[model samples]
Target: MNQHVASGGTAEAIAALVSRFGDRALTGLSVRDLHAHDESHHPASRPDIVVFPNSTEEVAEIAAIANRYRVPIVPFGAGSGLEGGAIPVAGGISLDTSRLDRILDIRPDDMIVRVEAGVRRQEMNRQLRDTGLFFPVDPGADASIGGMVSTGASGTNAVRFGVMRENVLGLTVVTADGRIVRTGSLARKSSSGYDLTRLFVGSEGTLGIVTEVILRLHPIPDAVSAIAGFQTLAGAVSAVIDIKRAGLSIGRVELLDEALVAVINRHETLALAPLPTLFFEFHGNPESIATLSDVIAAIVADHGGTPLRWAKNADEARRIWETRRVGLGWAKAERPGAQSWPTDVCVPLSSLADAVLDTHADIRASQIPAYIVGHVGDGNFHCVFMSDPDDAQEQAEVHRLAGRIVVRALAVGGTATGEHGVGLGKRAFQEAEHGAEAVALMRTLKVALDPLNILNPGKILPELADPEHSN
Candidate 1:
């Protein structure tokens, strides 16, 4: 196996890690650089070795090797994660889990599916299509289930089916010292001990590497529809709160700010009105569908929304959603020099409109190219700020804007991060967001599980979470 010759001790440790897998291991491959970084704004640091394991046994073996060698080992999925979750900043071994892609079991009767970590969310959905069951946690990146689980990701659908943390029934994870542990149960509820499953779900691979995942599936709804509510964003936000209070079961609710609408109009070559909009999907029978839409539409009008349009078929629905799924990228295209700084915040239903309006003023005052999109029914939205990462001043200003927004969210009893886990990028703000006590607790758990700090070092929680706890 080829390994990095420089960096002396770390290279040697990585080399020793490779030795455990014999010639089957790979080292110093240029592919390691590809595996080293993720889609974050952070700089990439290539791992000394990259291992693609086909089975959970191999994952355990690699983790064991890394543990023995005292080298940092980073587990990765599709590498589409926005935070620095998959990036190996402390260079050592990168355990690429993509090769483990497999559907191990599908218990349709129980509405659960057991699959290897690397299976993509869309792939699982495709396989389950004919089974009248669907796993609905979509991150809009065709992200792997492993990556999704790692970051505790949720997309536009989170307003309904919930995020990965709720959807995951159980998991087979390889802990820091390389012991395989399974948490949770297949049955609906469990008074389980410690709830390690949740502990690992959003841990971002700091505590353990998930090898397999059991996900809950919802039955296919009788109808799929998308309705666009045209309004000033404030109106759209108000309408959603009203609709939800009326006890309507909205499958999905999305908000696209005027900035996003303009960008999508140009990028997708669709002449949509350059106004804030809300998209809705309703489940259940045709009668219930009509009733909900009419009620929601009337509320939309009452809130000063106008020109509402519902998708005519699946094709139209796909077009509308495809745009929302990739709207961040499209918004960045508006400014040639800008990239995306995505901040996920969820506020209370009563305060959603104020949060959005404040975000608008923040963008204007910052004088930055930005767009906003939300899964509104749940009061969560993303402000995609287009920024110049190489410019120190610009980066600082972007982060400053983000901090203010996060502070506002927290002030209103919301969270700094709703779906995106507190990866390396969010470490500095964890104390402010979660309070010092909660952060200390997270640190204690980290030290308890990964005593040596060999797994995904410098990620999620700050430092080694006390570092002196015995394994």
Candidate 2:
């Protein structure tokens, strides 16, 4: 649609892929529709064909064929992305990576694992259960490793373990021209020539399609999780700042506003008090964890929070974390038939209280059924707006409200997107968040890596600026 493909070239490319992949290359409407859009509120756009490659070689071949025909290649993972990163807006080839599932190698000694793009986070952790080490970058969605890498995803554990960018040590990428290139290394640190791994880590499959990832793993430490309720959301946020300032080794720190806690209680069938709450997980040896818990308990008390309630056992801890994981789902259940516009923004630690409070105020004023939940440890938070799908005015208002949130974060020295990459949903804010020149440079890099504009086009960057025309 955007000249990424030649007239009738998509059909030819599909024919070529089908010939190579047999039944794995699907043209059925249902599959196309499934790959059309992600979890975002963006409108769906089905791909002309969905190709599943079982190996990096096959992925390279798909790229080669797509490049030859000028067909756009949209690499799709689990489609759990909040932004429209996996959406095939140009509708050419949706290169679904599910068939490439493989845990190629696990160096338990090195605390690293190499996996194909299709391996899900939970599945990887399950495999690592016996190893005493686990992949810690949990984006909560059981998202595929490739999708997590593409979106630069992070979750509750990110405050301690870091995001995809830091955890991902190496990658096997199939570039736009179908070249198989390996970036980064197994070694922990390097003064390498170019950090291509990072470039592709959050490129959202625009620069290239990631086929395999080598991820850093962490030893499963003795974890103790607790919940603290507060009278106001601001108090909970302030407690988070104090916990961080105290230099506590907090594994996970989350904040759920009173409304969201109520939703979680009703949906999860838990009778926890419907109050602004802070959920925390501390990791260390048992003695250290005990001391850390005591320190945290005192900090929360100082900030007007309820006494910390420790999870009695692992099952209780799982349930506590699970509640945070399925927050979006429970929110949807809270208001049946309402669509959710899940948006997130991260601010500096000092601005966390103001950001959460101001955003909560915005939600109350809008009169929209929205809930606030965030991984507040790193000053990142999400507001899930549940609006009637048929209510066009409500949809527009939510979009504007989300924009204001992003603007607020940017003003306070924060990112437009904390983890969800600059997919279609956040494209408009790129320039506002990073200046026009920086965005233009991003375009130049995109063009240099993907000259044909055939790799996940119309994503990340709102519009492609002609490098030759740029100053």
Candidate 3:
């Protein structure tokens, strides 16, 4: 079976799917349009049909059908991706996993939880409230667990608990050839054969469809949160570096520029000074929390930062983090009738100040209504650009500025993206960041695992010479 099939097979594939799934498989224009794109600025490209699979067996069946007909299978989660990962660029079947929302088991003794693909983060936490444990990889959005695994996502909590690559211990994956395979184990560490769990974690659904995940959970610790204003972006970032260097187990530290701070204050109805600021959270016992708070406050004062304003209660702390969580929304609200082009990059802790300061200057000079926010504790930050979608010149400028940010990050030995996977936007920078040889090995793995290339085609890897096409 050739991997690349003519468009004619797509109709047959959709018909076969509809026959098996009945009304669950939809061919309506509205449904197709809804699955066309994600939160990305990428242009929408609808799939031929959208199928909702209910179980691991059904997902496997869908993969088999797509493989047999050589139809692309794009997995759909909550549609929260910002890089066009879920878009069916090749126009085949969009496999919606929304029906697979089941929490299989909770092993509080082992500190782990098993969940189906469609389970959202917030819902999972709610279910785990009684377990005295929680899943910590929060990308702001109440993203699906499987989607978070696919993107290898991380957010504020990543500074302490790590990302999906570290937290996910096992996966039940549906291969491109309709086979169900299990990778990793519940046991913490294993010198096993191949770390397939990590490989598929960030493949962006190009390799396989993750049906379920076994995640490592952390205990809910006593926490304290505070906000500090900085005289300059450098001061705020410098304070973060010092905090990390001090070897304190900081739970979360985020940086929001003055512009974004202003937006959040107006949108969230909070009174935070319109200055470059850092939101800090510490987790531990009451004693350790108090010590961490005092030490960090003194450090902030050393860097010309204002006195740390501690959140008085749980509600106050929630409100403080809400400002950081909705940074992109506030950016869009700051400029109505404009599309946001959000991009992020990561650098060494030593190079973070230079990278952020330079990007801030670049955004200012471009005269674009953009703001910067960062998980600076982990050397990662994001810039959201607001531009008119219909204005070609403005779009081009936004693209140019985004490209420059990536280039600067790469120059400083940083990655093009820190959290957002290379769905479509970051594909071009793969070679520059990972070198030709590394990317070639990735292509080899893609071809080996998905010979038919029916799983989420045209993502991650760039348009290199297809070995199958070469004479």
Candidate 4:
């Protein structure tokens, strides 16, 4: 009834997992060594057992078994996360939620949809295409909606549409002690007690295992216009602030650092200036769209940024946008078998240019071949560094580099993580970023919901921060 580390590389402990979940759970699971980590430089640590649960009831049953043994349970999504959220650090049970892939209902009138935890963002988007509605919160990877909501996911669209916390309507969760509870409702507004959905949405699966999610959807844009251009780093960021100030109903506003742009050019097979860029997408009626584009172009030109360059037509727009959609994965595939350290730090809107320029300066000094990308309209950015985990020095450098960036973000009144939730990677910054009082409240909530600390332990909250010392 205690957490087990992956000390034994033998099958004896693995037999225990097979004994409970049957051969199907044990047979043909991902390579055990591979399962030991997420998409980060976190050293690989295997779970004592891995169980695949196919439904909410099955998840509850699995939870009961895990509780009986008092083994730690780490819920996993697509493993595309940079924060190591899905890594089973305590070596107990890596509960796989990929099998619960079902879309329960699409309430067009209410503009909401209910889905199982295993549903991927792009997969759900495919299903919603026909209804002229789509889920807007995409976290780069086709991350599972359940996982997205679990980590309060956000991405390019977040600048306009908000994150998972703003989009999710309700959740069906299995508590640590094997209790089934449905939180929140389909209603748009709830003066309900505690606002439970928001709590679990960004809880990083520490409170409970979310089995199902009800999410708000947006009407498919009547037309999407994407414009990509290169500019000096300072100019690109300034242009983004200007666009927001002008009140453009933009759908996606992104910035790619010059170093990152070169990678995109090589990996994505496109040629452009090797300078920081601002990618813009406007969604609205034709009249507003034209006027807004003109306003945005003039602003960019004023700041020495490139003029708006778009696809000649809608078909070309889709093609151009598709390139950006797969940008992260494309970059990942560039270096085979390497893990990416994605740093997401968001600064105050007014100080965005300063924050970005400072971070860029740091990146330039680092040895890591890093690429910077962001949902810049919101002053949130990601610098993805590809590195081999086996390389000790490189990994250590990444850790230090990432840590400095976090400190910088906190200095600017920003967070350690902007969109990607605090998983294993950001745990070190817990005290430095959030003060003593705030962190204590978080710990109190964690204890209240998951008394045994069985649900995704060792994430978000630091191991044991001296509240008063705050480090």
Candidate 5:
């Protein structure tokens, strides 16, 4: 190890790091500021320096140096996270994985793909197009696989394909002390030791930095598509529960409240019914898909929902999904000079209607400009509040409403976050959600893996970042 770099802080640390990786180690204000925050309401805080490591060896070396110096290391992917997971709150080094983008191997027979952490979801799927296989966890954003795994993200496809926990077969991680560790394997199932792959999946870079990923792939369905429209939010959620309870093989199910539909109308001319609507997809052969669609349509009609609006062609299907894909951006830009405060909570399928209705009431009572959208099939939803960050009073009210949302979900046996990890915003609720002993165990694990609190310090555990407890 370079002792001077290991012992250095700001300037000395930058010099030492630059020497090791040449100009790849950067300390310019613009570069440091760029790695500050994700899509959260948290204020941006710059890191002392940023480094781009192209290979796992470089990442391990950087980790070793950070461990030696007791400096915080924040692993950064595409920075598409909703929480402040990528933010460098302690002003240390931002280790960016963008340069490590690569598809290492594609095993068509095994239905598995090995890739560098920096590979984006869309890029990987594009490459697998001709292979008759595809990676299914699509978290809306073209997020890096590393970042998605870090947050344990799930999107529309999750309703059928499952989340990162199910799709990720294994991982290659660089531990706190710069040691490379491999966990899990390409095998379908393992009765081996601890399930370390899962332990690190939603760790948000708190335990280790993921360098490579082995993902389980699914065969592309012969008939893949969706259709949607509902009369009321409650009705839509009810239909979702009925479908799930009936064991309908729905590929994906998405819910968009009237407010979000209006926002989409303003952004683009889809001319969809400005009402609570659900988007759904069906897989398998044409005969099976038609049957499933008919069954779901009957359920929808039972709830007073309108007839499903089927997408006529692949282009039209893309356009419909595109509207949902860009809903966040459209909402953020709907109100000029305002920032988006995006939040999510998950509830039991049975409690979804109540959770959503109650949360919508809370938002309305708070009188904030907000829109609701979600993957309702699995009881996960998001509320995007538009407000000026400079307006302290408005911001406070928005957060207060968000807290109510989380409380409601927890009451119904749900998590404070579904896909968004507990970066800083949701750390306060982890204890309440998991209880005292569970939270303590989490902290103990953090300390065991990163004694110096050098890996993404000031995250997950409130105590680590608290100056009063940071001695």
Candidate 6:
């Protein structure tokens, strides 16, 4: 642990940063305020300065300076995370990676792409259009690749293409001492010495800062989507299990409870059935999709689900998915002047039905204006609860309901988080989910990599609150 990196003067450190980055080193309140918080309900905590690092070398230099001066470094991306992963709780230097946005390479032959950490997901996909290759880990918002990799994000496409952890092949990272290190490689598969890539994929920037990424890409599908309505949540859950059991490679299968459907209908102006519905997208040849659709239709029918609705064309398919695209927004806009507290929990396939049904009953009993929506094909679901943040009772009730849901998931051998990382919000449940021994190992890794505790402080692990170790 370097004393200079922990107790250096802020003004003196900023001067050194200015000398290195010149105009790129920013310290005005306006710039600092922009880097304070992420897209979560967590209160804003501004960094003393913000630095826009444009390359891996610059990021390495910034990291080394922070380490030398004992100033904490909080990596900043798109800041669209829901779990407060980007908030600079222990304000020091907010390292903004926006200028590093670049698609370095797209290898259609290998089906992989190399990109800078700050590249936006949508923008990178757009660039890959002509190459017939696309990165598929779409986490709804146009999040930065660095942030997505940091949180191990997965969205609608996760069921088929997999999460960030599966897609990311390697990373160019800046270690705690500002040493530039590369993990993994462009090789499709390797019996590597250590799985360092996986270690940082979901670390939430506590261990190291990712400067670049190499991601697995998928070819454009030949065929597309279908929709089905279910009378009950159990029926939808069962249908998903049946689809998987039948070995159908459905691209995406999402669940939207009646409440969420109603929100979509009201806001998106669609006439979808206000029932527990499953939205699906199937890939492969048209004949294969048609065959799989038949099996799913019969399965849905067996469970008393309504007749499946096939999208007539690409336009219609986009229209059908538009509701799902704006799901969280619609949920938030359902009630005026309400704060949105979105939480996700995942259970094993065998326990998903019971878990979802139980949580639904609990939400109804609690009387919170919350709606259930999830990537149910993979046993992950979310409930977006709308309430007034200023209301202490309402906040307490919301948290209570969220805790209950988490407990139910954990009871079924599930994780505290499925896609969303364990930021400040879920720290209390980490030990409960993964025993103290496992969490202690995680702390050991954090301390070994970031001994000064100067990287994205007060996140993920919660037991590192010693006054002597403070950044």
Better of 4 and 6 by TM-score: 6
Q: Residue 443's C-alpha lDDT in candidate 2?
A: 79
Question: What lDDT does candidate 4 reach at residue 199?
Answer: 84
| Candidate maximizing lDDT | 3
Which regions of candidate 6 deviate over 4 angstroms? 1-5, 469-471
Backbone clashes, each candidate:
1, 0, 0, 0, 0, 3
**Judged by lDDT against the true structure, how good is candidate 1?**
0.80
Q: lDDT tens digits, residues 1-471, model 1?
A: 011112235666656656666654677567887887787776788877888888888888877777766778888899998888888877787888888789999889999999999998888899999899999888888888988888999987787789988999899999878798988888877886888888888888888999999999999876666555465778888888988888888888888888778777788754677778777778888887877777777887898887467777888877877777777776776678677888888888888899999999889787778888888888898898889878899889988988888889989988878887777667767877788899888878877888787778777665433334321
Tens-place lDDT per residue, model 4, 1-471, is 122221333254345557756853543436445557876666677766667887888788767766666667788877777778888776677777788899999888899999999889898999988998999987767788878987888988898889888888899999988888898999987998988888898887788999999999999886666555655788888877877888878788888777666767886545656777777778888887877777877888898877677656787777666767777667777778777888889888877778777777877887767778888888888878887767889888887887877888898799888878888778878888888888888888887877666777667887653333211
Score residue 212 of candidate 1 by CA lDDT.
95
Model 4 TM-score on a 0 to 1 scale: 0.91
TM-score quality measure for candidate 1: 0.94
Per-residue CA lDDT of model 6 for 235-289, tens digit only, reads 9999999989998988999999998888787776558888999999888898878
Sorting all predicted structures by lDDT, with the top scorer first, yields 3, 2, 6, 5, 1, 4
Question: What is the lDDT for 275 in model 1?
Answer: 79
- What does candidate 3's lDDT look like per residue over 118-237, in tens digits? 999999999999989999999999899999999989999999999999999999999999999999988877789999999999999999999999999999878888899999999999
lDDT of each: 0.80, 0.88, 0.89, 0.77, 0.86, 0.87
**Cα lDDT for residue 59, model 5?**
96
Clashes of 1: 1
Model 3: how far residue 154 lies from native, Å: 0.6
Candidate 2, residue 379: CA error in Å? 0.6
Least accurate stretch of 10 residues (summed lDDT) in model 2? 462-471
lDDT against true structure, model 2: 0.88
